[model samples]
Target: MARSTGAVGPSGCAATLTEPGAFGGSLGYAQKLSDDDPALPFTPGVDHGYLGVGLDVLGNCFGDWEHRGNGCETTSPAGTAFRIPAPGANMVTLRGPGDGTTGYCFLTATTSNFSTTGPWPSTLPGQLQGPTTSLPAGVTPAAVPSTYKFGFAASTGLFTDVHLIRNVSVHPAAALPQLNLVKQVSAASDVPLPLTPGQQVPYEYVVTNSGNTTLTDVNVTDDRVTGICCPGTTLTSGQTMTCTGTYTVTEADGLAGSVTNTALAHGTTPGGTMVDSPPSEVTLPVQRGPGLRLEKTVDEDRVYRAGDEVSYTYTVTNTGPTELTGIGVTDDRVDGITCQATTLAPGASTTCTGTYTVTQQDAERGNVINIAFARGQSGATTVESPPDTARVDVVTNRPALRIEKSVDDSRPYRVGERITYTYTVTNTGNTELSDVTVVDDRVTDVTCRATTLAPGASTTCTGTYTVTEADAVAGEITNVAVATADNGTVRSEPDQATVQVESKPCHGKDCHKPCHGKDCEPCADQRCEAY
Candidate 1:
């Protein structure tokens, strides 16, 4: 016999032997045992590990099926072939020779056939239970005409003194790949002060391969953020990786009080199949003064079909310490919003309603997602709440656009003062959009950073407007902006932004007027209008 040395097992994957006969090498004659019962198992090789062997068709016998804790009768082992009884289903055969002598045992596992051969009712008859011979990774062993390996141990409970591996000859490893990912905000972001607009929100993602196989082409991404960096794209089995990413908080996120986002992870298997992990989500609190909260929800609890009438409810609350007037909801898809009350006191709230008939185009794409915001006046300042988003199921890859408009200040302004207006355009659908443009009714020249956008991408456009004497007397300036993408084929509903203009006295002066009973700075030509 040839002499050599090596360690082998499911983990080591040290050797591959395939020929209808006994295994050779240091495992040749099999070590002798001094103490224990003869009934213990010496197969599977998980304790030390399995020697990787790829097989096409199997025709040899595997032994000691009864010692694998299967309770198989030593007298009639042939009846142990496990079957599922499924349509056209079959299982491997287990046979024993008529001779009373102990038979040699071999362990086998499947690769591509894992899908059909698994969800096994119990461990294979020849694989041992507990830890010693336990399969690596504790995953269901594939039962098909695939890889075959044998194991010898350093004395099982009832077997003779068997020597563990004593040599070194390794083979290329086989794979059983699985991927797991976890996402969280960096501890540094958790501070006494809530994160504000333009502040950096750091995130960390932990990636791991939960299976026995190596994974390649691994990637991690966030739906609402970008610029993620990981050391490498390949992960060996049982290896863990950490990736980092960042996002800049927006004013909308602050006004809404929180920012929520989801991250996804995926990897490719050797067999070319892609394995994806369930989405992981994290919500970060944002800086905001006590303000209005609009909770928007849909009535549908199930998937929607064509012609479905979707009812949306808007619950507007005065979360601020002061009262708000002109409280109402405005949606991107509906018109004529009706509310229970147009004014809310410090802690008061009211309900608003709207209805939409799902079109076939929307139903086919999956579901509908709409955004809405509320507007109210607190003293002389006109305040608009941040967006309240709602989703049903899905959206088609068709071109779609969304726009959010906001102004630099909410405090009452005097004539001749300039207000900086920001119009943000976003591509919400699953397709790339070209020539994305924002048109504000008030600002004729809106300049944006990018005119093109991929799905879920956004761009900020800015313009400046000078408050006029007419705007001061009107008490406020309401500016509306609409965005268009895909050469105007897709258009967004109008988004309105308002700023309070100082109330003018009997004769309109460019001077700031303190409200209702308070004096107007630099008294106007005439007496003040209020108490």
Candidate 2:
């Protein structure tokens, strides 16, 4: 057998051999393109001593091949080669660019009118164009190659071997990274201060965040300590959410004080960022300080007579942390008044007293006397009682008197006859009379005998009646009487009386006159008529 090569150009016909055939016998191989090549026939035949074949590849046999003397004595090129007389059965193979170390991949091409410029290696099937491209899983062929080289279409050369041609290529891929943020948290500071009972005090809080990562949505929540709460809840960045809250103080054990106005401020970060600050925190402190108290004892209402003594009392205490100095109580209320007290200390107490007298003459009931108390220095600080007062009531003083007297208006008496009269005095006024005296005015014909009369008491006086011979004088004598009580009030009515005097007969003559109608006569009956 002899070997020869033949050549074919872009058109269908084979080119005539200009050089002589070097080897003997018809050594021919037809166009054996991959199944994807449009120029390769699905069903091939032999014509003009050239033959076609279809081949399936299991490995990279194309890169490793050699020629033997029985076929052609030729140095091998770096591609697949074969014998000139084609076998009854054959396989065609196609490939894409890849690494030899990793694995192998196959490509599929479409069958269509073979044109070099035709669309090939497309995503669709049946169109003819370029070389085969790699087919991933489930992919159909794109376009097929238009002109594939047939081995027989070569010149009859001494070293004749068919070379199979293929092509391959490669590229790479890309990526990106990620980012995140964290949160913050915080804790509280200290305790709070104390205030007087029923009094109020303001408290403060210091808040912060402590967590692992930077926080995104930062918010503050408040847990109100009963009876204590923040004036506002929301806070701006870096702004102190001051809780302007108050606590009303109440009495507790005097030794151990009570606590109030305790609250918590908690912070939160919204996103899932790592917490640079603590996840949870409290911003407020426990409150503590000295306690205070006040107590009063005296009742400002009282009554006392003029020149009478009145006393009042007061007590003060220190119920807190610090001591109280110069604690004092005073009442400069009424005239003739005085007050005093000393000092008080923390958790200690003291009492004081004051004395006063109602001295004014007209000081009446319900009059006010004021009193007050001080707590700091001797003369400086103090708190006063409401209506600051002491009430007073007083009594009255004066004297009064009344009197009566009786006397005889008419009297028949001798010239030296004795007579008596009496008088009485009484005190009907409210006050008792002291050092009282009574006096009687003497009559011209009568004489005064007794003098003093007690209040509601009586006294008598006597006068003398004389019968001196009244031969030359007329009939009778009259006299007047008068009396005075308290040496000032006088009582005497019609102050005089009539008196008669009759002389006894001297030398058998009648001296007493009886209702004298016509005087000095001797009455005689017919029998004893004598004149």
Candidate 3:
């Protein structure tokens, strides 16, 4: 069989032979296209052979082949195939654009025919091809072809062979980082009502790498919390990292009624490009401090008598948004008063009681005064209830009477001599006195002007009495009187009056006769004379 060589064109182009009937069995010339070409079953014109037989034979052939004596004139021309070897997955890693750097990639294309003009054009998407370069003979020996002079005509000759191609693709790798943040009350893990000062809160941030490339120097930041950094310095595709931070609640937070926090993620690609994730934010509601109230009352009436027992009641209530603890009650006047509930929930109330006994001092003062206090704690703050007071009036009984008695005679009295006695009664008690009367043991027919007497009132009466002979002999007359009030319910000590009777002084004529005249005879020393 006769052997002939075919002319080679640039990679990605079809190779053909112009000589016809070079192979004895064929009546027409054939042209073969690359298998990688999208247009298949290409129709040939009148000067060309049938479709399937021409291109199919050479399209499936690899390396170099020499035809024996089979009457085949020319061999198939070489074709180029493109591929990426370094990054087998067709992906590359790069730093962010901020780094002012770029990522490198290598692409290679192999040819079936040998030629000095090597490498090939590439249609890879989003990539630009670099200058063609040669590979060592040991690297691709099949791509190196043996060159010999082949004559298409007596005066025409050309050089052709298969070529091994290699080219690089330059591009910026993608750098993308995503961030999310969440905030919650550490105690409840939810929005806590009535959140006061000194309460602990927690914040969480999650960072993810969603780009095709790896990220370096990843960092996280929060508006409320500090020291937010990822655990890893570098993150591959679809990798995620989480960080946590804590914050203490403050009075300002409670007053604001809400707390807001924001988180942001930053990273750099190998290409020195700076990238940032969208800011994520979370807001939680805060509750105010507890409100407390107190009310004090008494079971008895406002007025109470001495030696009476009084019961005092105290009520404590919580009216704020949160619960209160360490609740207690106290009264200035009442002792042993305690609240049984140690904790009070919002809009809840509890009651306690204490007892007090009335004393004479209280009665004298006319009223009893007391104050009650209630207190509780909400978070780190202490809350107090408005003070309450209870007043009571006390009463005491008082009834008294007094009397005085006197006799009309001031000189010595004889038997059968008439005398007048007088008596007075007074009520010195706080209340009215009824059935008031006076009695004199030594006098008869003594009565008071009035029977009933009001406080600070007085009554008087008189009676006639005769001096007794025995009283004259004794030289004195005494009368005792006493007063009674409220129908003898109360009595006063006795009052007394006395009259002194002396022996009558004698005149010169009659020694036993009493001095009857104002200028009665007087016993003189020696020159005494009767008048």
Name the TM-score of candidate 3.
0.26
lDDT of each: 0.56, 0.32, 0.51
The sequence of per-residue lDDT tens digits that candidate 2 reaches over residues 1-531 is 122232222122222233221111112222122211222232111222111111211111221121111111121122222223221111132222111111111222232312323222222222212233343364322222111223332222244445433452322222111111111111122222223444444433333332333334333232322443444433344333333334445554223354422234444345544322222222322112332233333332222336666665555545454555655554556332222434445446566566666665434321333545434432343422222333332323212444444546465555455545443444433233443443434333332232443333434444444444451133465544554434555333424545565543222233332223233322211122122
lDDT of 1 by residue, 201-270 (tens): 7887777787777889888989988888888998888777778899888879877888999998888888
lDDT by residue for model 3 over 96-210, one digit each (tens)?
Answer: 0000001000112233223423322222232312222333344332221111111121101121333222352433244333422222233225423334456666665556677
Per-candidate RMSD, Å: 35.8, 64.9, 53.7
lDDT of 1 at 241: 79
Show the lowest summed lDDT stretch of 10 residues, model 2: 67-76
Rank list by lDDT: 1, 3, 2
Residue 174: error of model 3 in Å? 72
TM-score of each: 0.26, 0.25, 0.26
- Native-vs-model 1 lDDT? 0.56
